[model samples]
Target: MSKPLNIIFAGTPDFAAQHLQALINSHHNIVAVYCPPDKPAGRGKKLTACATKQLALANNLVVEQPVNFKATEDQETLANYNADVMVVVAYGLLLPEVILNAPKLGCINVHGSLLPKWRGAAPIQRSLEAGDGQTGVTIMQMDKGLDTGDMILKATCDITPSDTSASLYEKLAALGPEALIDTLSLMATGEHTAEKQDDSLANYAAKLDKAEAELDWSLSANVLDRKVRAYIPWPVAQFTFIDEKQNPQRIRIWQATPLQLAHGKAPGTILTADKKGIVVATGDGALSLTSLQIPGKKPLSVADILNARGHWFTPNTPITGQINE
Candidate 1:
């Protein structure tokens, strides 16, 4: 048994929290934890603590949530920890030269996707959207540049056909801790050499938002289905329809499936809506709406939505709005 190394963990979100839990379970000398400050969330509009911050507070680890790490005051705060190493995961805020140089072993970043690919925000979603067959976590020695850090460990995970963002995220979240432990174990033995990422193969996973989440009916059913999966749990795919008073009722597409429909019908055209579901013709095929959320009502299954307000989306009805560019 070797002596535990002091670690300063920095991250945000549930994915980061998952890794922190594993570190605590392993009983490392966690000097302090760094995470983002609480932000307004939910219907109540109350300030909600970040996932990592909440976990740290519960575990009694010192928590730091600074506006910017580059500030002299913030750097002083981080240096006070006197940590042996720093671990970062989805920290959102960038690490500056002084802070990165503070820890004896430097900072290790547990990125969602393999380094040199999906190297920015929304990695998980972008991987699925791009139809990548596989993705994994990469533990790297952090640097000033984006995710350009040298790789300490690489672990792969398969992307299943039906794997949604939510499901795959859960799988990857578990993998991060195991990989982190292995990297740290090797580091302890002084046998680990961080490998440089291939810059030529790099790709950026641009941030996603409600604007990109809007459905483009002109796209094929397959493409739309991917969007639905990629944007789940945030900024879901949506389409517009005319309501009773002719007001635009934007429906958030929660779940859908692709269908082989002979197309020639205008994209965004509703082909039918009986009991099966709303079969909407696309540019190349059709999509079956399994679940959807009307603008002001709760999310409803295709059957339920049709039962309550089927008149708005009748068969052969044309969907309003231009296919989102």
Candidate 2:
């Protein structure tokens, strides 16, 4: 008969915390939890515990926070746990080969995307930005290369037209923990198979940057729409324009949609501004900015913003949406 495994769980963010919670509820024994060291956050700059660390403390699990595995003491501390397997989910620190091989079953990961499709730091956002029809969770056997691991299991979900990075994140969050628990169960019963990834099909998902959020008007409305959706809840899609005051003003786009119509105007020109939407000309089509946020104000609908600041988005004006950087 198969027995539950001793797991050493490593993770940091809220997504990781969700998986940890699942493991805590499972039959497996969690020997320890590993997360990065606390760091300053928020306007106050006070030290803050990551989601994983807070959950570990709440569950009274052993928590390890080594800066890195460079020190022999840290590696030895991990080795002493004698864990059967280590589960890693969005743990920021890179584990050295020695630490990776510490557990009896080595380490496995709960990656946000299907293996080889989107591999690296920002898989969730990159998948959405690429306009992928679907994306899913991959339970991968940890290897030395970056997300280049054998896949033990994959559970897919569609990326709807209305889905943003944040919404896709919620979907994967719901799918990932269940997949991780299932992988563990299969491993316990010796029923799991690991499949090698086709490197030729791999697409590296580079980390999100604030600079990438700049709305380049030259791009097609379809491309810009994807970017706007992908950048939400982080560096919200933004564009600059010379306001009526002649000063450069930056506005963040919260919600927008691509219109198939063309206005024959230069890219970034404001075609129309009304209660329906703020229609701006793009390289191929137009984009209707439905929700937006300006400096010192919360996000508001175009109708509400127009009621008070209609002059800010006057028609026939050109916005500085060119990607200079």
Candidate 3:
């Protein structure tokens, strides 16, 4: 049998936590875990541990939450672990050259998108927002540059028509652990091949902005639809409309679909409204909103929303880009 590797697992979010869990289940010796320091979260601003740190603690593994790797002591502490390899997934911190080269087998990362494409902070969301047909996980040999690394392995998945960022994240998170484990095993056996990334084919996925959630009706319905899907479970796609009292109300769109409406109308004008959905005209076509929510209210399907506040979403009302006082 191949010898178990001494692994130092580093990650922060749920996506990273899943990979850590998979490593723990394997026969590899996890020497230590590194995660971001606890940050203030929720209403009371209580300090909250990252998903990876929580998992590592639950499993009784050594956990370290270093804010940065610039400190000499931190560097020495990590080196002391004497890990054969380091596995990083969504760790959200920059690793200096000293830390990167400290491990015997060097550091590797489980990135969310197919390498050479969508290589940045928000790859998953950017892929969905751009209407890409497919995306997957890439096990990359880490380099100093941002996601600029040699790909050791990759596993692709189709982006379905109904997929949202949240859904695709779950899918990729599930796929990551298997690919990571296989890559690590191959590395241990000296069977893994590293493919240099093509610079010409690379794309950067810039971090998502809350401002982008504001729906611009001037855009094509197809574009709007993709944006809605991309922003799910984060800064949700939103639009503002004037209520009966002339007050502006903002509504968050949870679910929507692009449509091919025959009639030419002003974009943002409500074409139809019923229990099933609200169809609004757009620059190219129309968008049918299946689910939406107002501030302080849980998301509800159009049918349920209409049952309580049907008057709020009147047909012929125009959704605006910005709320007017």
Best by lDDT: 2
Give me the displacement of residue 44 in model 2, in angstroms: 2.1
The TM-score obtained by model 3 is: 0.96
Off by over 4 Å in 1: 42-45, 321-325
Q: Over all chains combined, what TM-score does candidate 2 have? A: 0.97
TM-score, one value per model? 0.94, 0.97, 0.96
- Candidates ranked, most accurate by TM-score first: 2, 3, 1
Across residues 1-325, which tens digit of lDDT does each residue of candidate 2 receive? 3689999999999999999999999989999999899999999999999999999999999999999999999999999999999999999999899988999989999999988988999999999999899999999999999999999999999999899999999999999999999999999988989999999999899999999988888899999999999998998999876666667777899999999996899888889999989999999999999999988899999999999888777788765533234
For each candidate in the order shown, give its overall lDDT on alpha carbons: 0.87, 0.92, 0.91
Model 2: residue 254 alpha-carbon error in angstroms: 0.4
Task: Report the CA-based lDDT of candidate 1 relative to the real structure.
Answer: 0.87
- Model 2 scores a C-alpha lDDT of 0.92
Question: Which candidate, 1 or 2, has the higher TM-score?
Answer: 2
Worst 10 residues of 1 by lDDT: 316-325
Give residue 161's error in model 2 in angstroms.
0.7
Candidate 2 Cα misplacement greater than 4 A, ranges? 320-325
RMSD of 3: 1.8
- State the lDDT of candidate 3 residue by residue for 143-186, as single tens digits: 99999999999999999888999999999999999999999899
